[model samples]
Target: MEERNRSASLRRALTVLDHVRAHPGLTLTQLAEAVGLSKSTVLRLTAPLIEAGLLDRDRDSGLYRLGHGALRLGQAYLDTLDLRAVAAEESHRLMAEVGETVHLVVPDHPHVVYIDKVENEASVRMASRIGSRGPVHCTAVGKAILAWQPAELLTGLVLEPRTRHTITDVERLRAELAQIRRRGYAVDDRENEPEVRCVAAPIFDHQDAVAAAVSVSGLTSRITAARVRELGPLVAAAAARISSKLGSTTR
Candidate 1:
């Protein structure tokens, strides 16, 4: 009986939350009617949620709505939706077009983490490991996201140097990001690894926020300065195509 009551309570809580999410700012009475629960039961259920910050009630208007805690939980769920699997076809197409290794990366604060890759036929392969972190200040994948982060977060990064050419100065990095924004792409320019270069472009979600990025990387011996210029637009195109598939209405 105790276990059955607990399960019923949990189901009720979830149903109440789902109702609140679907109809934001509903009153206590409105929620009770929507979920077919008694007003007293809703009061009991919402008390714990209000304490946990998952739900909030407006004292002035006497309405209930999801809070910051709920938003965090929703975002966590969205983050786990396999972006690599979502981007697989686009990554393969890009690999075929550029003949270089392609990476799918997401920002991990001070680093960018590789979630997936499409490898090239070349014998000299990129040293990147899937699920490994790379510096945000120098890697093309990192630069692409850095260029899209909020100004306060972008300015506060430590800009740790990985190579001689790595942009350690805030002003220099800001300038580089400006160029990236204008061109819709970013480049490593041998900053992450000796004799290696890469071009990358941001992938935006339906909210028009940079969610992740796609990068084309190769040995600098074959991926020359001229080749970088050529592949830059192609990378941006691939990223845009992937973003569209991910529900971005942006062209």
Candidate 2:
């Protein structure tokens, strides 16, 4: 009897929490009606939740909503999702939407190592594979990660040229990183490959730190400068969505 009663009470509390989440800023009466509980019973249950910081009650408007305690629990839940699986789903979606090759990579010393990829059906596709690495100074995904790197980490890193247009100057690279930060994206216009272009954005982790990047890569003939302007936001939005799935608060 004790166990059954405790289970019932727990279910009721979870139901109330779900209702508050779905209809934020609901009143006591509104929540009671939605959950089919009496107003007094709802008040009795909410009192403890509010006191525990799981729910917030607005004094000015008499509204109730989920609080920081719920957020902490949600963040904990999201942290368990496999990162590559999440990135794979987003990469497939982005590739299908943009009709371009999409890649997921983590930054390494002077390079970014590809972990996942979704290829386009174009006759001229990018010459990259799942384990391929690209120079950090010349690849869009690398720049996306580098643009968010702390100053201490950036120091003493080599900026050797991968192509004629690869950024070998530290100050120029810093300026480009500033622009990338402002725009939430980066672009590699034939800086890594002779005629290949790429646009990418950083993927944030649970702590809102950049741990990886996502990119769309293709031949310049297809991913033209004009098309780059169109694809930048699309790739960035995809990356932001993936970061959100990874429990990043930055999105």
Candidate 3:
């Protein structure tokens, strides 16, 4: 009976991953209905996969999608998967052009994790490490991914108040994300840190979902509000280049 249960659970997990991959953004109700399982059962089966990094949950909006682990696995199957290398080269060029720090981040469990960073010689040094995590509600890279995410996932995120500038109001955050989507980029005006500012844009995968975010961040003095406005398009262009390298035809 235990073995049978395990097999059934594995099947459910695979089904969920397939559905999420195909749909890009599916609500729990929608997933449950599509999988012919109860909502509770779908949630239960997905929990372990999510914990294992094979699936992702949008806490803000209660949506489920394939996670980075799945992406890694897919990349592994390919003989020539060096997008990150390409991204790093592009990031270096962007940093040289903008004279600011460029970062590449991917969504982790409840936050975005910096995967890579290239700092410009004249840019103010940052406190972030390559593996460090940042809150999704306050950072430009996080907002860039969140803005393009499914509504259900956004609604389901737990908005803990981390700081005075942290956005704790869900409705307000949703509005802000909507604006980010419409603007095609996101800005951090000391939202995450008192004297830091950033501008970010989303990187799309071949599936056209937000796979990552790339940004330019620095001290507010160097990356002032006016500078953010100026850098927004450049950041967006870099993101577009990265996305194109990843096989996104959106640009």
Candidate 4:
């Protein structure tokens, strides 16, 4: 019972902080109402939060707001984020969901460097490995990230043909990138590897800039046109989850 009471108190205090964060300048009465607690109970909960520097009450208006401690905590969390570490769980989940390999890649100027790979149990394994570099014009992971990059980055870019299907024409590549932006995902239908297919989506950072990409890859027989359409949203959702973990508000 003592532990239960302590847990309840901690929850109530966190509730108060959440309310203040969502609605800054909330009065004592408004906070109490928002938290569905009595004024006395709210005060009791907020007292420790204020003492801990997680909350502050205005002297002139008696309004509540988040304090410096909250900023410190948020910054601490942001500081600990590693792109590969933050994306690992989601990458594995996507591979399991799609029954295909998942790859996480980050931008390296005109190319994307693979940082992680989660493989599915199949008779055939992907030839692509971690640390491999892929061209932005022909790979799904590359196009997913490049779609969100500045136009100037695409100018004078070398669109070397990797396969017969690779987009070598600059105008056509730009058009496909525009389509990728609209669909929130990208597809590589034997453009990078002759027998491989992939669906990918961009991951964003706290600055709302494209930071990386997550992809689902498989043999052409496994990931067909219809399957690409089916996996597009799933891959995009996985990327969005990783982006959220990276503190991105934009999906």
List TM-score per model, in order: 0.67, 0.75, 0.67, 0.89
The alpha-carbon deviation from the true structure for residue 122 of candidate 2, after best TM-score superposition, in angstroms, is 3.3
- Cα lDDT for residue 203, candidate 4: 98
Ranked candidates, highest TM-score first? 4, 2, 1, 3
Candidate 4, residue 214: lDDT: 95
Deviation from native of the Cα of residue 13 in model 1, angstroms = 38
The models' CA-based lDDT, in order, is 0.88, 0.88, 0.86, 0.92
Per-residue lDDT over 1-251 for candidate 4, one digit per residue giving the tens place of the 0 to 100 score: 99999999999899889989889999999999999999999989989888888999999999999999999998999999999999999988888888899999999978999999999877378988899898988999999999999999988899999999999999998999999999999999999899999999999998889999999999998888998999999999999999999989895
Q: Which of 2 and 4 is the better model by lDDT? A: 4
Give one digit per residue, the lDDT tens place, for model 2 in 1-251: 99999889888988998899889988888999999999998988888888888999999998999989988887788767777888888889889898989889998867899998889776466779889888877899999999998866567878877789888888899899999999999999988888899999999987899989999999888899999999999999998998998878795
lDDT of 2 at 192: 86
- Put down candidate 1 lDDT per residue, 71-128, tens digits, no spaces: 7876776677667877999999999987999999998988889999889876477888
Top candidate by TM-score: 4
Worst ten in a row by lDDT for model 2: 151-160
